[model samples]
Target: MLLLFAVIALILNEAVAWSPTNSYAPGNVSCADDVNLVREASGLSANETAWLKKRDAYTKDALKSFLDRATENFTNSSFVDALWNSGKTPKLGVGCSGGGYRAMLSGAGMLSALDNRTSGADKHGLGGVLQSATYLAGLSGGNWLVGSLAWNNWTSVQDVIDNRGQDDELWDISNSILNPGGINIFSSASRWDQISDAVEAKQHAGFNTSLTDIWGRALSYNFFPTLYRGGEAYTWSTLRDADVFKNAEMPFPISVADGRYPGTEIIDLNSTLFEFNPFEMGSWDPSLNAFTDVKYLGTNVTNGTPVAKGQCVAGFDNTGFIMGTSSTLFNQFLLQLNTTSLSSFLKGIVEDFLDDLSDEYDDIAIYNPNPFRDTEFVASNYSHSVVDSSNLFLVDGGEDGENIPFVPLLQEDRDLDVIFALDNSADTEDYWPAGLSLIATYERQFGPQGKDFAFPYVPDVDTFVQHGLNSKPTFFGCEASNMTDLTRTPPLIVYMPNNRQSYNSNTSTFKMSYDSAQRMQMFQNGFEAVTRNNLTDDSGFAGCVACAIMKRKQESLNMTLPSECTQCFQDYCWDGKTASSSANVSTLGPASGSVSFVTDSATSTSSSSKKNGEPQMPQSHSMSWYVVFTTVLGVALGIM
Candidate 1:
């Protein structure tokens, strides 16, 4: 048929086009250890503070442009300029929450809306917000979005998605990750050999290996845009050398994970939170409160000194490995291979390989030569702790229920004035965030093991849903005096939770795959959620966002509050209230609970193109997705 021919033609047209601008060339890969000769333990490194100073000017210029646009008609527009001219810059951050591929796709949409590079985004979107951010953090699947962007020189998420058929496209999730042909450009058999050989090399080097090694390697094929298929030459520390980052052109990126003592199944607020940034890797928790030079991760160090006089390790901090360590929960994909549609032979291969992993090690990333092994100087004396002799084991950061990775931004030393938290978590029965991440974080700040950081008062989960807070944007800590402690003023929070607008973007957290059309729909849904469908329904949303940005500075300078800001606080900020709740039986589906969905005028701002009520792929894109699906399956079966 003509339709079949058209599909085949599309497949052939896209199969071999490789552009120089989008791909990298072969380069040298060093496996040698490169250690910094000096070692010292410090709570906050001087390098980070110095970098922040260099970044301050850049932030001011970006914020000025954004504020001027958002506050165009406000009477106090002059006050915004005065604050900037007086060197009273507002510090800002953005936090992305985790929920597997659903979270990553939605986070990408929010980031695109924040990025000025998105087409016409500045007209109504939160453009230049990302540029003004001092810190950006992610965990689990959210790490894939942040890590991919950081690794690719802060490439626009729109660009990444648009390049679907190009050879340079890194997020090629149409091909299942377990497919041998999906690993690299080599023949399927050779690619499998390469992956196995690489892991064997690490094991032979006396390092412990876990399912995370394989999981991370598979993820690189989807996230790392390098000519060297497995990202073998791309180390996480190499991000420090990029001219954009070295010159402080982008916000600092932080990836998070939860520390689990061996044999432990429960994760609580007291669990040690570990972070990996460009400069270092370690915990801010008093238990193991020292960071090690990230480039030398595989080195055997004790008491902050290399055990071997001249020995060090460098390449072990591979980009894929670091991302994998932050999202070790993906190892479940390997454990549950039987549940997939993979051919029985391929499923057998996965089962046979994973069968060797013990129950405790199945979900953990093993970091041999633990970086925090001998920290006698730390307050908790973690030198002989459970992790020291047994090595470091980490799982998904959300395991502790603090899914937003806000720990780094909460550090008092950072002094962030506002934070825009994106909640793409699947906390409710319908698989949408119900402020669970925020509640978990607020509770942690008040626990016995709580840090000195202050957080805004968040009501119970019932209050969050009853007020429609999860379905619409809300402001927290808009007034500094409303904070729990006057001495520890926290940053203003602009909470944007995922909701249906152009599409129902709340895909189940366990759903592992998305067609190109579904992926694009998810992006559009998130874009509309954050921008309230480009402020079509609520024209004042943009101005309210600007007010949130200026709250700290306005209060600091003792200037009269703008009328628009005062009105915004009244409309968007939650006033203290509580409600009692008992489970209700009314429901939409057989398995559904008594969920109350809010009806906002904003939800109908735009209509979807799909007649079935779910967003659909365009005709051209639908055919292209079919071609890709057919080719991947064909190649997979051919390899077998």
Candidate 2:
């Protein structure tokens, strides 16, 4: 153990190199003239719209490649050609819901299927949709997946697997974060010291701290190991600095969080939904219809500019903290703390940290220097409780019960055509999604809180189970002109729920550790869920996806619904029907998948595209890492 202490000291020396950079320093420079990054939530930001124009090239190319292959018999060749020439291409968004690691990995899989970069994804599934998409949204664990991909140079899920256990690589979750540095208590102790000291540094700087600070710092290890020393100083706003992000090569990513004020106990549909993107972060609701620069989060701001003259601050929007802000500290941390195998000192540290947070508001991500302080957006009367507060408090994006990150994409000004929603929610008792998210979203649209944002009408959980909407892909908002009491057509929603299509991917949301095989299996299973078994024989399914994507513009242009779309709609679109009886326990997909993948007549693919057939597994991480490096991390610092 003495020799191990020496080894730990060496590792600590290496970690010292990552010690908190001056991310939260008082830069003496005056704020930029236009650094008044806050904008009214009337439409998409100019930065985002401009980026979309730049992204048009990539989206069009991706769509053309995908549609050319999938549109074989579904649409005539002439119509397909007209798609690009007429600029009638659809705008797509992808929303991955919360379910902790289950949501993270399963959402990763579903995206793997849509991602054209995945080998043979286009041939066997809806591969190119990811590239064609304009936005990618996530909440809670789903935010972890999306944020991890977006921050790490827009890496692929396969890349995460390929680089497992390598120094500074992400997704090495074999050891619970509670025990990050192997089972050696001394090593874990060393890590804890680093984490505690980092938090202390922030507090010593006069910022408020919470368990979320410690929680986010700990999470940075698995999502970004280079920061495992508890100095996750990288900011989410730095995404704009990435080469691919600057080039607009990938979909713009957004993570969602719900605002909670002092004394607010429960998050409801009316809770203001805040979105954090690279360019800005704020809520679209009239209550706080304004955004502020995401990079300068810690600086005291009034209206739109800094409160302190000529003093701008940086580094408050730490990447992991933003992810933690969206997830909150409850689901991932408290559920594990107070359990066995923890040192008394460690428990004392956590207990002290918990005691410092706002009374009764423990499930929060603290953001000092609230930019919305006295913010005056379009309607001054509707400003929320946070507008005057010195600090803003946020909780899990799904705490309102809308687990899927849909509110941001639903912004009317964004004018989205369709959203491919991957619902990996653990709404059901057994952990599978049961459509509660959609139901909440649907009902919320009619409430005053909805701000007139339109969404499709949805049935209850019973109907979802009876109709097996959870079992397979389902399209809502199909009734475009047919929708009742709507001012105009809303974006169509293509919801893909996680099911046991190939593997039982419904791992518990709080089950923090994942072996390489479990991770890979979940990834593959999510891929298969969206791609469908023998999807090669099911081209209509892809065509149906295309039809949903095209539906909005197609209606606007008065283009006739193609004969192919008629059948496509019949097979997948959900009509406004409710089940009279209560739902029984629902089990979905083939638990024991069969080799003979049955397909409808619409499934079609050429022989050449079938070469690299089914989704293949990536090289797995060695089990030896379990004993070699169980990297657990913990600490929080703030002066609130």
Candidate 3:
């Protein structure tokens, strides 16, 4: 019973898994069916179809035979010898020779000259078409065989050639085996059309019949044998369907900004090439009422008996001026101001229309007299300079002070003076190396300084700290170690030190002292909360220290004090420093000035009790047996 069950299961499984060898599927058609459909579509004659089929079959067979022979030769001969011998044979089809038929014919002469006139001349007529075909086929086969051998032996041959040995023997053999007749066959233009028609027919049939197997077979009949020595034949239908044929069509033109065609102008402001009034600033204006010529530089008498003067006037220099300069000059000035900021204000007009419009202006493609090619001139010439003045000025030495027409007004009170001090300490490298890359996230979120004029790097903490203390209130990025004396003259500092341990005690003391110190009354009436921190790691420790000092100084000047000492003490509470309201302390100023200081010994002693090693005591000691016992023991020990 078990054996029967097993056999039945095996049979059922095999039946379920089995797939039919041949089954009709949608969009599948045979190659023969595809060819017939194409012929029907193209309306080709029976003779044409027959001719293509015969030629294709013969060519494929010849290519296959050639490949086989070549492979065998390659296995037997050295690569260098094979390549040299291979060149003697004639290539087949398009691009057969290195330079095609022209090169082949030039090297070997006409096909008729090489014919065996003494033997086969009687059989083939004057046209010699049959003889040419046969000779070409044989030559193609020989070339294919030789080429394959050369390809296979390439590595070995290259090695010998690179070593600079004799290649003359090989070259001689290749030249001697030339078959001139083969060139004639490939040169036939009609043959290419016939092949093309056959390929088209196969492709059309493959598309309509929905028979992939037939389509593949037809493709194998077309390209494989011709291209790669029949390793596997491909049909023309397959190559067409695979997108090779699609590339033969024409390409689309590239797009341009303006709707006008390339190499043609949409606007002509100067009216040099196209006809229009020269006085008009925008496009072409024919009506003379609104567009009149102007004299840019003229001599005139004004307000005196004989006052000689040169002034720009409208509607004068008509024939001499190519385009009236007055209106264009005014428009150019407005355009310049519109595109630039006060920071990059124009100094003087660099090139006036009269100067730039000279013969030398022709060198500029935009300003070309030919309106058809001067689209860029119409776009850019209306402005004094398209780019910023800073960039332009930096290029031609410094700003030309002698020639400048205007000078910028200086507002000393509104202007801020900032001095940057950077730290070049070894510790900075781990975080902000000298040439460290700015983070992309930071750039996207916040604007950084321009590429030029960034802070310079300074090595060591002392120099940076000193620079910070001495710099303006706008100075940034300083450290606590930068300060000379903490108690005597605590400069207003604003920096978050990297190694907190280095400045923890000093920072605590400074914050507490500033809160209660009387010297803060000399400065402003505001605290450090309003200040901004612009110190990047690249600013270095010195810069940071300087910035911090500046902030402290500003805070002293601006910060207002609360009414009572209790509120003030709470605001600047430093457990590390003494808490006192003593009036005996003297006042001390900034390092550069005098400051007030308090001499409170009791406060100092109390401050020491809050040292790092101190232990905390509970508020209720009466109920805490541990505290009570300790107090009692201390009292008894002191008495003993």
Tens digit per residue, CA lDDT, model 1, 1-640: 9999789755543432121111111112233244442233344677787888878878889989998888888877787777777788899999988877888998899888888988767986888999889899988878899999988888888787678878667576655565545545355455555556656666656777777776787788778644355564467877888888888899999999887765554456777778888888887775566688777777676765667766666667777888988777557555543324443434444565455543345557877777767656666533335335548887778777777887778888888999999989876757788776777777777664455577787766666777788898899877787663533888988999999998889875645656677788888888889998988967878888999998988888887767888888888887665344342211111122355321100001112323343332222112233443443454344331
TM-score of each: 0.82, 0.84, 0.12
Task: State which candidate has the highest lDDT.
Answer: 2
Highest TM-score against the true fold, candidate: 2
How many clashes does each candidate structure show, in the order listed? 0, 18, 59
What digit string (tens of lDDT, one per residue) describes model 2 on residues 229-341? 53355678778878999999999999999888745554677778899999999988877888887877777778877777667777677787888888773323542454343
Model 2 TM-score (2 dp): 0.84
| Candidate 3: C-alpha lDDT | 0.19
Looking at candidate 3, what is the lDDT of residue 357? 25
Q: Write the per-residue lDDT of candidate 3 for residues 1-640, one digit (tens) a residue.
A: 9999789755553432211111111122122211111011122234323433444443334433332322232322232233324432111211111111111111111121112221222122111211112112001111121122122221121222232323221111111011111235332223323323332342343311111122122222111222221112121112122221123111100000001112222111111111111111111111110111111111121211112222222211111111111101111111122112111112111122223321111111121111121122222323222111111000000001000000000011111112111111111212111111111111111121111111111122222233332111222212223333222222221111112111111111001111112212111111111111111222222222222212323332443211232232232221111122331112211111122111100001112222244322111111223443343333223320
**Per-residue error at 184 for model 3, in Å?**
41
In what order do the candidates fall by lDDT, top score first? 2, 1, 3
Worst 10 residues of 2 by lDDT: 597-606
Deviating ranges (above 4 Å) for candidate 2: 1-29, 33-37, 226-231, 329-349, 353-359, 534-539, 581-640
